[model samples]
Target: MALRETDPPEVGGYRIEDRLGSGGMGVVYLARSASGRRLALKVVHAQYADDDEFRTRFRREVAAARQVSGAFTAPVVDADADAPRPWMATLYIPGEDLGTHVRRHGPLPLPKVRELAAGLAEALRDIHRAGMVHRDLKPANVMLAEDGPRVIDFGISRATEFAAQEVLTQTGRVMGTPPYMSPEQFSSPQDVGPAADVFSLGSVVAYAATGHGPFDSPSPYETAVRVVDGDAELDDVPPELLPFIRLCLEKHPKSRPTPDELLLLLRDGHVPEPRPLPTPAAEETRPVRRPKRRRRLWLATALGAALLTAVTATTVAVTGGDETAPGDLPTGWQAWHKSSKDPSVDKEPVGPSNPFNRCAATGRSLVCAGDDVMATRFALADGRNTWARPIDETADDLGASTGGTIIAAHSGRVYVYGADDRPIGHDGMSLTRYTVQALEAESGKVIWKTVTGDGPAASEPGTDSIAIPAGVVATYGDESQYYALLGADDGKVRWKRPLPDPDEQPCMLRGAAGHAYLICTLYTGSDITGTSVTQLAPTTGRPSWTVKAKGGDLDLVGQTDGRLVLVGWTGNHRTVTLINAKSHVLTTVRLSPAQPEEASVHLVDRTLYFILEGGSVRAVDPSTGRQLWKTDSTVERSSRPTASGTRLYLASPSGRLAAIDLRTGKVVATSPGRDDGTLLDTPSYVNAPPVLVGDALYVAYGRRSVYTVDVRDL
Candidate 1:
């Protein structure tokens, strides 16, 4: 986030300040330390800065990240790996990981999963007595600190006196996270040792006590053939920690246990005791199919316009003149830029090219997609792309946005989020499905598709859609639990019901003053315990007022004046509540020093941006919470700003481009990105936001370009 206008505002001397995440070996940031601590750093990605085997695996991750310094780790506060892009830092660790606290609070409490299996078996017995071999201990490398479980990534840690190990196991690399690896890390990665970090700490303590992954499958080559055939699902685990996690998932590596005997069987209790069992009675208990859209993959790749920020869920008009008569362009408009890959008219790429696209616009079309990009159709004036459909390519192993997203054009149709995968009756299995189409926004043809979900969310086939003026709105059964709507131009469902989702934990549908709502979040396991919201009924899903609320985190953020705002924090100040979408009466407003709880708020035009996670922003004043001015949107992990009156736009998923001057928060222009290597290929998936269309903006780049720029050229 934030720092990327080609980063380096300080790297080896540490000053960067934002972006703690990027991957495929590079980008980390959130720097500091010239006596102001908070470090993290990382670097190494200027096209692998002239790789010599990625600078020898970043010089063996800065020499095994400086011998793993202890106290539950976040050590190595400085490194270089012969500079020029290679760097390191560390010591930042402030908690939130353990797979994002077991996916926003769910598992962990079998005494915190046996105290996270005795603080990750004493941080793998101090990185196996400092000689390394962490070989990636999952749950996103642990973290969870209130003075406890730390671990962290020594990038493919390997230092039993580090010999080459084939430049650290790199042939078509599968280095870690196949449900916490270990079957000698997929059948002997240079004979992985220290018992593969005690069998990835018995699959990260059975994914912190069952929030999944104990040879979990639905792909990863079937969890590496059930983690090399040791196949331990350990049914809801807790039969007193299932015989020391079935002797640390033993499938040889000298049949498991040593991180000093898994910390002496977790500090002398010898482990197995509190055995209970026999429950399953309420009609033989049911609930476990799982895949509850996994937060719809962060609401279809980064708040797909905050799940339609409200009002007929945007029938185009974030300033795009409700259809070309007075300003929002379109009558043979100018400022051109194209290439949604035109290799003599499309179809050459069938792989890698997904430079994370994503789009949505109407009154002058737009389209776009990602993950091996396809649903292409760009023409908000001179960028002429035209039609594109083809690429279901067996849904290319469903890894986020597989050729689908047009996601809403409305009246003259468009919609998208496709994917099909053919044969539902062959012995060779194939059920990807996904649909929601519509099309014909000036002839791409097909006017109705429908279906909605299928395995691996098919790659966000429009996850939790929404529009509704009697048209879009989605969700379908199999834990999406129903609710339909459809008919914008005849796919015809016209309202179905069910989907209130009693305690479904990670809920969220959103929309707002042209109504939809939903929200949910109550979770009794691992505590969140209250936050319902409801609202629905646009043509009969029928709740129209529910609320529930207890303690903090309410969130909706739009409807305003006709009521239903939301935002909330409550203790050290930041409320703004509101409600009354017809006398529901709430009110609040507080707001002081509490913005960044992973920011993102938004609102626009009635003020209250917030944003943060590095592209900065802030503003506030949701009617008297005041604050109002903070800048920097130099586009790094951006997308989702788009305003229009006094500018705002935004982009980056390596397409770069920012704008921002909504009243002097000045970054008025910035662009440069995608000098090829899409910054380690996924500079944050499916970004695609700056598509404005009237005073021309468009924005999307590399791996098949789009470009437009000219909010009066900033």
Candidate 2:
């Protein structure tokens, strides 16, 4: 690629030539030093240069790269962290990245695969000997030099010393490409040793031999899931190499072969002659199957969008096949769906190109609200729209202007908070009058409306603004210190109270076990402090119990058997905290060191499950705080998981559905995701979690439509 005008002409006394590539953190350029030595200069992005944490991380990467001394690895030449844009230079091998090579030349032969493995093993041995772990070792980070291969990119690498754990965790960054990451990287990143690099090397070797990763998926999240719960796609791989690669791809890091062991096996010539394996049946490899009705509907929609009907199915599946068992899908129902992009609704402009649609289920009816659309109900049996109403023009304009939406439909009532910006008094200042309106869920008729005094602007634009449960409707800003529980029937304030500490802000509010609990976190400027969990009486706004958490951010999973189960994170390590509301006895169990800041935790019965950003799901026992099982679902940006019976359901933003067995943590069934042909710069709206009512599951598709699935068929 040619160097762009914005790129620096020179960096760190190196003469810039052309661009090598760009990554999440910075851009790499092909440059030459003053002495005429070719170099790869990596200049940190301007935006990241201003971040103190990123700067420190960049410094560590430079330091780690300098420590490594190996023939099959790129060596650091020079670096200047104090420069205007921190930059590092390394010996630029004259070759292409492994990914590019594979994409252009197809899969490599067995001999080439063997050679690549040996080179990577030697490189890893050198890196491990230097007391460093190359946390990220994807294909794109490996260079196919003329002699062999050179491992590069230490941006997320860490020193093996004890102090490195603290330094790396302090940044709270979950680093690595999902498809190439080890299971431990997703479940316990900070504790990852040299074995993680071996796992990545196996993935790279698989890609080299098959032109595809062992756990390839449409998104990184889904790929991560496969890395954890699914099997390697080794049917196309050489039969003799399958066993060697499988050992490297084991879920348990300790079970994987060390670099030294791999070298020994390669040197011993224990690998057999390459032999072709029988092609697996399509049914065996393809897990997600679309019903005939879904196929026809999708074809029609794709034709409307002038796109070919290309459906990509998931290759991973649970050990158990999708069967009509006692606890599977409900009876007397078949899977049915309706696209929100129907001709009637597609023509209506919803202000934001991609707006997030929120949905709630009552009985068999699903009510959804978003953007220009107020609230619409659909029959869960057939996905038929019962009623559709346009939001009030006054509220619509305000929501569009501020990029906010009114959340509605809960407990048989639709609630909307609208703003009436009317100027009052001589000063000509517009008084932002916030109105709380309640509408009939079935008919969409305005039942009652009340004016709530000027409240803080909604903390989150879409999903986190309102919570309606049982007899009360609660509203709070994402970071507001004040919260109010309104009567569900009349839209009147039942009880409003300030959080325990005025300086502390509430991050989440939920109603569980007939009680409303507020989780607040203390913030000193931009840094976070200890979190406070308080149980409040909905009727009287009285506190029942309050637990002050440690320094990490806290997420309230839910109450299990009268115990509050929460996941807390400090640095990169996550811990499960169980608090007994009555006894006020708090037990904090430190989990393996992993990045849990961006994970969503849910409590079903006595088990708490964590869905991480990288698409790994782990089930933990709150009583013992022991992780029962961890599986990868490869569904990126997935909705919060919902459980029923012994099955757990999860949905991604792209409309992919995955069902896991609660007892085994294996994916039992999956649905081919719906990919509407709309390409927007940003997601239209936040994804709503799958709502499981009886034998049916309801999912909000992007910000456009809602669909129902009969669990029995799954």
Candidate 3:
């Protein structure tokens, strides 16, 4: 029978509107704040009202919630965590919990999956930064609002006291929901922290993706034992998201990333806000005053029931295999052939020398440039190094720069060089400081060279230059110069404009709206010192328009048709924007946080593909702000994306290249993923983006070197 809504005997001053829900330790009701704001008010059970110990615990819980309130979490409105009956109030978000959402709608769509993962990760980062742990992070605690996800039900354990006791066994032991508990939670609750929440996040991701938990054992005992001693059963987790999930579920807390670390690893765009520093106080508190014996028994029994026998069997069958082996690719997957790391150097680059590889495709080959590394090319048809030349590495070397225009893929081979002969060396010394050179793709000979500044600053190479079909060169300058120069074939500067120096961070020359634009990070010395973007004229260095972008650095993907697309970070959220340079228009699409799950972002022809940190891919239209379609593939990092006609290609880090149906986002073919953990701590990665040349896919794997995968299946 249903319990009818009734007035609460009393609460500070507001009257209870209706009973929202009831737990073993307290009854939650819809209540109003002094100003009439709606709140979920939880009042302790009558039996525990007389216990001083319970009140103390409730106070602690309230204190914890107050310390860590922000966008990702439901903010506290009012609370009496230490009241005689132990009551607290929080803003009531309107949405079903994750469990109900999934039960009603089935698994989430791929884009939604990525959004959830990113949002949850950011949320967890906020929770942890406050120096507290959500000991009980589960699907039931998440609310899926239309704007995004909001984490709720914090500090319930302390307010109810029964929450902890209810989950304990008859042996006077405490336990969590078996499927959602982390190994640390089971083996040592006292030792658990943010990482424990990560483990629960893994379970949440698994449940959202495949309708089952990672360790859904047949019985509560079995589930507990598996969580403490067995491998995570992740059959339904897509291959791409596997690594991210595994990292979160690492048995060793040290192996797991902090919330901030996870945010950095999962995002490919902008962050809007700096995660506020966690308050010195704890963020989560457990109620300790309620009855222990009954609570424990009830918790055990509920967990046991939730792990139905059929569910466990299906879960085991799906994720039973050991998927750590290298060169293993999911069926129908394609390969991407570019790498962010150097496969030949053996040792990873010393610093974050280059966080990402700049890529562009024309005709049938892929071209790439990186920090301190000269422009290099690999045949898209086969994984073979076409040519690699060393560029300048000094702080201000213009000759070392290769922005993006090295080889003109669309037109015939042409060399880029300085029109007048100026001494290439710095200070005219014997040290031949080379000028910027553009070489012929097939011949590998310099077609053009442009001399830059002098001294150590001049020793470094400038970014890639753009070679428009009209023979105009667009290149960015160092800190001293803001205007990216556009030189005629005769080598005379057409125009120059000063760029903004915000944080004085590295700036990139990107093309959007069929014109050249500048993207840089402006630090305001405030809470948000993250990335921001501004559009500029290619020749004049004038602001066409500017919008605040997210991220520490920015990269230019390409102008599809004419829309200027850029990716940046704002806090933990990656904001992707499509700007119309001609109309001075912009459309910003923010990705939801990647939580226990993982995701990647790729822009193809104005269609944004959010590759879940898992291997599932969802295609969305940035213009209309709608999801087009999605597909699932093998899980792996270091995979680069390439497009041929209407089809997209993906290369596994393990050596497999795959062809995907662009319209449907489905993998039509695949190769293998290389396993290389030698550089887990190092920057060198075997698998990166694959280069597509004609029908071949070039793959670079960490420690394993580079290889090729054919696209016959596609």
Candidate 4:
């Protein structure tokens, strides 16, 4: 489509070439950046610029689209949310939308439909992983690229965190295409989640297969009723796909299969290969074909019942594998597991719902701390329990607590925070006195104990307060208002000093070979005002150098190549700042547009790796501010990645481990995830980063279990 004479020549510096399309909210144009990168720039209609509600919706659409990046989703490149006429630009994909393609070339073939299903499932998985639900997933929003289908348009998407506030939709107003909207969207818009997308996927696939929606009606009002109450018109849908589609369209959200489940089913070859369409002459004389005998009877049973059994049976088979062949195990290593919970003492299963099991690896031993248990050592070779000790003091019971035990093991010594069990203050909130206990790594016997100070009143489940490096234990005392450094061998305080500010709080404390660094955030009321980074002298607790940062939230990731690497986010943009510890010089590199705001940053050597919420990994050079590579790992909500040479490893909450090649940012191998049958309302928290020592990769899956894998085989 050619551009109109009245259209602007450029938008936010992008040179507009031709008209792509126009929707209710804006006009999409094909444009190119100054760097010669092509983009689909969407400029708001002139009338919407003055409408506050339209501007807010446009801003949210930009944010929601930026949160998702996957193989089958268009990536947002740049945007000006505050512009006079708000606009967003995404990667220019050269393909027609699914609706246009079907209207021009009739319904898609079975093979094409199967491919569409797989691609759309992956896209939805990425969207849901980033805490969003694409409420308006219809055929028109899916572009049929050469590689696969790409889900686009987040205009009506809602972030799960802020779902309570229906910022875009008014009360009692339907917000999606009537034919594709889920029943929940019509009945209760505020309660939609990832399941809502699944229901819409069923309708889209049905329309592609038969060139008409499953619940097609002359009027949208009747279509809404059919979506909530009428039976789907799937008689024309392929038999191999009917059952899966039926499962997706289940009335209950819980009854519908997850995107991952759908992907697995699609990849298992259960759906037969699509046959080529018959010629017109052959069709005129050819007899009609019948459904395959094996699948014919299976379709007789209600799809909902059969799908439930199939899903349950598959889950059990996958999770029940407790043994593996010796040949399959890593070289010079055997698979091993040890229970964090003692059956004789505790009743509930050791998982996210109960207490969290925190573990660290040093040398040949693995140390773990949990509720009631101060510290326990296990041999890495065979997963045998070396020693265990019980602590008498109980943790504060505000929520599902993890017993606030901070443990670090190094140099044949385990450092832990032991509770004193004494109440303080007028409120009777436990004074939460903590004593740092140094235990022998081999015997679990306390070598020495030193009183630290009162701990936090309510310990958050995943917070760790101490760090041990090079035989030095570093702890922060809230009541004493000081930083303390104690000798690991003698348990004597080497030095103690008050924090820089009376109201400042420690955000991160990391220790390396000979130096320890502390980062403190200064809060003014409920908001953070600034951050302070101090490199402390090994034994004196004195600052060797201090860097103060304001105007953004700053975090010290770690030191790389004699430079301290820090990440900061001001508003919509993020930057990586590298400070030279010796020269005190700083170099700042602005990240690419649309980078994840809450990405987990890890510094490995000279390269910085960012793991986004949707499991996409981006490697950048801090010194030059150039992105080395970016790739999707396909694991949702994974842990902070650990690097071994050129390979980076990460583990998901589901216990799946992925190894990626850092040079190319590609996943080279992945192990089957362990399923503990633990279901939660939210994603499970990662207790610790993947521990890589020699040939073994130790991963803790929340409080439930710890897994040891031999990466040499991978």
lDDT of each: 0.61, 0.62, 0.52, 0.63
Give one digit per residue, the lDDT tens place, for model 1 in 65-178: 577666777788678767776777778888798988889997888888878787888777777777777677888878888987888766435421133211112122345666
TM-score of each: 0.29, 0.47, 0.40, 0.48
Error of 2 at 589 (Å): 1.5
lDDT of 2 by residue, 1-714 (tens): 998999888987789999988976678999998888999888877776676666676677677767888488889989887788788888999988999988999988989998999899999998888777888898898899999999987633541122221111112235677789886665455567888999998899989998988776533333543464334556566765765676677655655667887776667634332223223362222112111110111112222332111111121111111111112332244576664432122244444343334565433356665555555666656677767654433432323432223353432345655454544556645444455666655555677765554534433323333433223335443334456766654566666776454445645675444356777787768787777787775555667778888764777766666677777644443567778867878888766534365566666656776777657998877777677898987766676676654687888766778988989999889887674744243433456567554456777664456667766678
| RMSD of candidates 1 onward, in order | 24.4, 22.7, 25.5, 24.5
Candidate 3: Cα lDDT at 328: 25
| lDDT (C-alpha) at residue 565 in model 1 | 73
Candidate 2 Cα errors over 4 Å, as ranges: 1-334, 340-352, 355-357, 371-374, 389-392, 395-398, 401-411, 414-437, 453-470, 473-482, 499-508, 522-529, 593-596, 679-685
Maximum-TM-score candidate? 4
Clashing pairs in 4: none
Better of 1 and 3 by lDDT: 1
> Residue by residue across 255-306, what tens digits does model 4's lDDT show?
5777887786677633342233435474311111111112311233344232
CA shift of 13, model 4, Å:
71
Model 4 vs. true fold: TM? 0.48
Model 2 TM-score (2 dp): 0.47
